[model samples]
Target: MGMSAGYELARRGFKTLLIDAFDPPHPNGSHHGEPRLIRHAYHGGEAYVRLALRADERWLELEAAAGEKLLERAGVLNMSDPDVYTFDGRLDDALKLGVRLEMLDVPEIVKRWPGVRLPDTYRAMYEPDAGYLYSERCVAAYKKLALKAGAELVTNTFVTDVKAENSIVSVRTKDDTFLAGHVVLSAGAWFKTLEPFIKLPIRAVRKSVAWFEPRGTLFDAGTFPGFTLGTKAGGYYGFPNIAGAGVKLGRHDTGVEWTPGEPFEPFGAYPEDEGYLRRTLETFLPDSAGKLLNGAACKYELTPDDNFIIDTHPHHSNVILAGGFSGHGFKFASVVGEIAADLIERRVSDQDLRLFSVARFAVAR
Candidate 1:
């Protein structure tokens, strides 16, 4: 998010300065694990569909600018019980925004795509336009663009303090201090670093992603599509074998909280902590879940409502706060980049962002 925003701002001639604790393509952040799902039908809420629509356009723009295939239109399959809340709102939002999508039943899904298996109650929603984003490459591309646009980029430099004085936002790094006309606080999972200054009610949850070799031909691109299955327990999402290693699987419910900049340590409390996740392959996705090949940790800065907060600081208009993407925000980096830049440039977005404002948290509009 920071990289995209910084690059967009610089491209728009903002005299931007993009700083990060680590260099570009760092794996310590969320833009890792090969691919991120980009679904048009947002299950969280309908309002997100608006942001996602803009995101689609910006992603294409970035793809064209980078001269690389950043987004793959492999389509996304959503599976859940009829009672379970899925991207039903995504359909409404996409229809309202003129995005092409479809909702399918079990037979229709099975007939169209024979690789997946669901319970009798499970239904599906398919979005042909939704697919996957090449996260790491996109980040590198944005950073490159930002640098080419004459934006100063400093890496391996941690921000220690932020002092805003009536619109002159100043950021203090470990070694030096710099000031800007406006500041965008887009620190990802490390958003807690600004707690003393912003007092945001966000929590960083340590999450993991696991890759499993396919059992049979189920992992083929013709059969399996990137999908999110909503079980009675929670949501489990996966990607096809885009990287040739295997199918990528991740859980949405299991995560631990840690302070910003803290070293990550794996928990070995429950067998399921490691074993159970792998065992799920034997039960749920027997064909796809074979040997647990690799797993790595990422972080999610979550809000109570599991939505994002993308607005200015309630007390500090000069300092824009654009974090708390919940867990599924990487797909919107393109649009969010433009939105952050627009907010800084005092331009208006066609999408209504009132639902994402800090005022909703009682910070005073």
Candidate 2:
């Protein structure tokens, strides 16, 4: 996400400098997974539909520029009970916005996609436009482009403080100081620690991802589209083996609490967390859960309402903050990069950012 913003800024001729505490595409940060779900019919809200739509174009543009496949057109199936949040305002709004989608009964979903079984009561909304994003590849591409665009790339640099005076923003690292017309805090989970801090309603929770060998052709890409399971007992979401290792499954809410610098090793794959995911798979599609291959841990910067905080600091206008994505923000990284660029350029975007403003959190904007 950092590289996305940085590259966009550099591309816009901002003399940008991209800094990272840890080298990206590395497990030290949140975005390490092979694929992240990209669904336009967002369960979060309809306001995100336009942003998601714009992001799709950016993804294709990045893919073309990188000369590599960064997004898969596998489609996405949002399975849920009729009354669940996924089917209500979120899907309804997408429909109103002219997003293409198909409603499916349990039998229809199961019959059409023989990879898994759906309960009789389960319903689904299939977005043929939805698919998966190659997170690691995208970050790598962004970093490469940023450097090629003459943006200074600094890695292993620890940003200790950010101070704004008048309209100038000074970013101080452990070893050097740099100045910029504006500062963007796309620092992911660590944004809470920055100076002149805008108290983010973000909780960094440890999340785990597991891979399982397919029982049969059920996990084949031709049959299994990327899917989000919205069951009664919470849910899990994943993609097929397009990028190739095995099928991936991640529990949305089944994460452990951990702070920065804490060891994620001991906490990942805890029995209960695994049990919850395993139980869900067992109930819905046992064949897909037979053999677990590998698992790893990541973090989610969750907001109270699970929305993002993408706005300038109320007290410190020079510092722009973008964090608290819950877990579904990666797919929108493309448009978000442009949004951050706009903020840095001090342009008022036609897109309404009220839902993501810092003022929404009662932070005196």
Candidate 3:
């Protein structure tokens, strides 16, 4: 979100300076996963569909500007549990938004994705245009464009303090203190690092991803679609074997609670993570579970209700806060970037963002 926001702001003729605690596209952040799924099912809420629609456009624009294929058009298969929340609003939004999506039954899913085996309680929503984003390439493209647009990027600079007062925001680093007319805090898991200064209902938790070599062409990208499923155990998501590398799988639920100070412990360090994936495959994609090629651990910053927060700080209007994506936000990064820039410019966005306000959490607290 920070990279995309900096790029947009710089493109809008704002003198932008993007500073990262570590050089971006590194393995440390949520963005380091092999690829992130971008779909419009938007079970998060219908409020997100508009932003997702805009983000799809923005991603296309970025791809055209960068002249690189950043997004894949592989379809998405949303496998939901009828025993749980049955009406996934995406069914309604698909028609309203003119998105070409179809509802698939258990048999249809099994027919479409030969490797997937699900119970009768599961149904699927298929969106043809939904796909995956090559995450690292996206950061590189945004960085290149932002730099070309006259934005300065400083990496490996840890932020020590962020002070917003009297129309000016001061950000202190280990080496220097910088002041700006406004600030956008898009800090991910480390959002708590801001401390009592910014109280948010966010928790940083460990998450895992595992890659498995497919047994046959049955699980390759050309024939299979990226999918998310609600099993009896929990929710699981995965991508097809793109370029024959392997099938990638992950879980949505949080792992162990983590903090910035002691964050780098690998997810696989907990043997249960691997055991869970093995069970997930043995039950769902039995044939595709050939060999575990590799695994990775990352952090997920979450909110209690799993909704996001995108609003101005309660007391400081000049300080905009953008965090709490709750494991499902990269697809909206483009639109969020535009909204962040719009907030900084003090302009009303055509799309409503009231659902993401900070006050909602405060009232609940």
Per lDDT, the best of the predicted structures is 3
- Over the full model, what C-alpha lDDT does candidate 1 score relative to the true structure? 0.79
Query: How far in Å is the alpha carbon of 42 misplaced in model 2?
Result: 1.6
Clashes of each: 1, 0, 0
lDDT of 1 at 6: 91
Lowest lDDT sum, 10 consecutive residues, model 3, at: 85-94
Q: Report the alpha-carbon TM-score of model 1 versus the true structure.
A: 0.94
Question: Candidate 3 lDDT, tens digit per residue, 98-207?
Answer: 77788888887887777888887787888899998988899889999999999999899888788887889899899999889978888899888886668887989888
- RMSD of every prediction: 2.1, 1.8, 1.6
Clashing pairs in 2: none
Query: What's the residue-level lDDT of 258 in candidate 1?
Result: 76
lDDT of 1 by residue, 239-314 (tens): 8776567888888876787788677765343345456566655555677777767777777788777778888878
* Residue 86 in candidate 1, Cα distance off native in Å: 4.8
Q: How close is candidate 2 to the true structure, as a TM-score?
A: 0.95
Minimal lDDT window, size 10, model 1: 267-276
TM-score of each: 0.94, 0.95, 0.96
The sequence of per-residue lDDT tens digits that candidate 2 reaches over residues 1-365 is 67888999998898888889988878866788678989888755667988888899999999999999998888998888655544767778898888899998887887887766776877888999888888999999999888888788888888888878888888889889998878888878776667345566678888888776767777767577899987667777987765347778887875777676676664344786466666777777777776777777787888788888888888776677888875889998888888888877866655668898877776433
